[model samples]
Every structure is written in structure tokens, then in C-alpha cells.
Target: MLAKSFALAALASAAFASPLVVPVSGGDTPPADQVTISGITTSGTGCPQGSVGQFLSADRETFTLIFDSYQAQIGPGTVPTDARKFCQINLNLHYPQGFQYSIMKTIFRGYASLQKGVSGTQQATYYFSGESAQCSTKSTFTGPVTKDYTVEDDLTVASTVWSPCGADLPHQYQVPDHA
Candidate 1:
């Protein structure tokens, strides 16, 4: 019975394995005009202590979005000169020409400069939140197109923020419980 239960669980999990995709209804083709992408920065993995659940702020900082052809505004104002060294962006894209066949995956890079003297490389990803028909389409049986868009917020330090007191390392210790 235990063996049978384990097999059943495995089957159920496999049945639900699928990649994320956004389907465009009615038949439409990608626009000739460039797509504009924008998003707020979120801490990826190794974030400093005390900064979680907060959206990237424009205060004392500036944000911009750069794509293949154009650079657009993401946040208000300018990035501080000192903080520019630590910003980075990257992207992961999936495109399928037909319903079942995979076409390609592409990666793009972005850079930023800050007023506070901080600069860095970052990864940015794009998502197809919405699409508009700037022009009309002429075919229906063209092909099954699938696109999965996701932006990665991967920024690294361009320059280091100097602390008056050198690096402070942390030491972890365990104490015996009285209970």
C-alpha cells in the first residue's frame, strides 16, 4: 500500500508540470514598434539585513529602463551618483512559434549610474502584461505563438560604498535551552 501511494503522488505531480505562458486571443502579430518594459526593483536573494517587502524607491535615487532601441523612464528623477555602481538588470524570454514547438530564448543586459557614486551590473526581465493592436492583422491560421516573459532584478555593485568603520562580520552561537 505504501509503494502504491508513493507512485500515485509522483503521477499527480508530473501531470501538473507545465511552463508559464501568456496567450494572445484573436489572431495578432508582434508590433513593428519596440516594446516598452518597466518595473520596480526587488531584492534578489542576498539582500542586506532589514530590507524586505519594500518596493525599490525613487527617493534619493533614479531609475531607468533601457531596451534594444530606446531608453525609458522607470522611476522619478535621477539615480544618485554614489548609488549607480550597484545597479544591474537582466531578462529571460521564451518564444514558441507553433503550439508545441519551442523557438528561442534570449537574454538582455542593462546598466545604471547613481549620484551617490554606487554603480553595478543588474539583470532585468520583461513580462507581457498587456498588448495593443497598433495595426490590424490579416490571418487566423498563421500559427500558435507562445511567449513567456519574466524580468530578473539582478544588480551588482559598480563601486563600493565605503563605511567609516571597515567590514563588520557576524558570528553565530547557540545557547542551551533551560526548558
Candidate 2:
């Protein structure tokens, strides 16, 4: 729910600079597994076909998404849909056997310029296809401000949804109804 939209920034940084490392409890070492992004798909008004540009680092540890037309706006003459936007990203990650993981946190980044009394919200739903459990996080911003913002939502261990240890089905981001 973005009352006044962002123009240039993205939901995530241009790329994640760090690699994902799986560790055992007590700081013990964990086995290594080859994790890769087999494919990705996007479907939403904010990320229609061909609107998103993707890039994966050579090491495959991180990726980047650039949006050409993802935005939102409000006030007179703006349609209802213009006030809200949804961009669902479904990532197909391949993990080795016995590899299990959960989304402990989610961070959203962007810039907004909202007038007084206007409020905007950003939401993300995480779920793997064929998995019953799902997790979501949301951030709300009250206006009378104009600045860049970074919001983080952490999912506790018990509240997080873990991926199937050795499942064949692909894990994807849960898209909202609007998408």
C-alpha cells in the first residue's frame, strides 16, 4: 500500500554482496552443498513480463533484479491500482541433499515521498511450492516525509517456515492475490 510511490530504487539492493552460508549449531562446521538458482519467474503489475531485468553473479551466491516500470502513485486522477503494487518473485533454488533452510529475516529497501497523513505499506510472502507452511512480513510508513528507507522483518525460528530437506518441487515466493 504505497500512497506515493518510489521511482528509481528497488525492493532489494541491486545485488546481495554476501554469500549464503549454512552453519550448524554451536558454531560447528556444516557440510557444503551446491546451491544454485535454476530459474526464476515474475508475475505482477509491478513486474510484468519483460519488465524485470535479472543478473546472477558468476559464483551464483547472489543475484540482482532491476525494474523498468515498477512504481506506484496516488492522489487526484490516480487509479486505485496505482496506489498499490505487487511484485512477486519466485526463485527456484537447488540445494544438495539434507540441505534445509528457513527465512529468518527479510529486508525491504526503497525511497518514498508521501504527503502528510498518507501511509504506505510493503509486504512480502514467502512460501515454497508444494510446501504447506508459509511466512510473511510487512512494513508500514506514515507520511509527511521524503527519504530513503530500509525495513527489516525478522521471522523467529518457531515462526519461520523451513524448506523441505530434500524435496523435488521448486520453492517459490508466495504471490499475493493482486498478482
Q: How accurate is candidate 2 locally (lDDT)?
A: 0.61
What lDDT tens digits, residue by residue, belong to model 2 across residues 2-64?
445433236554332222334323353234337676776787877789987887777665566
lDDT of 1 by residue, 11-42 (tens): 01110111122223434433312211123332
Clashing pairs in 2: none
lDDT of 1 at 126: 22
- Candidate 1 achieves a global lDDT of 0.20
20 in model 2: Cα distance from truth in Å?
5.5
Per-candidate local distance difference test: 0.20, 0.61
Q: Give the true-structure RMSD of model 2.
A: 4.2
Best by TM-score: 2
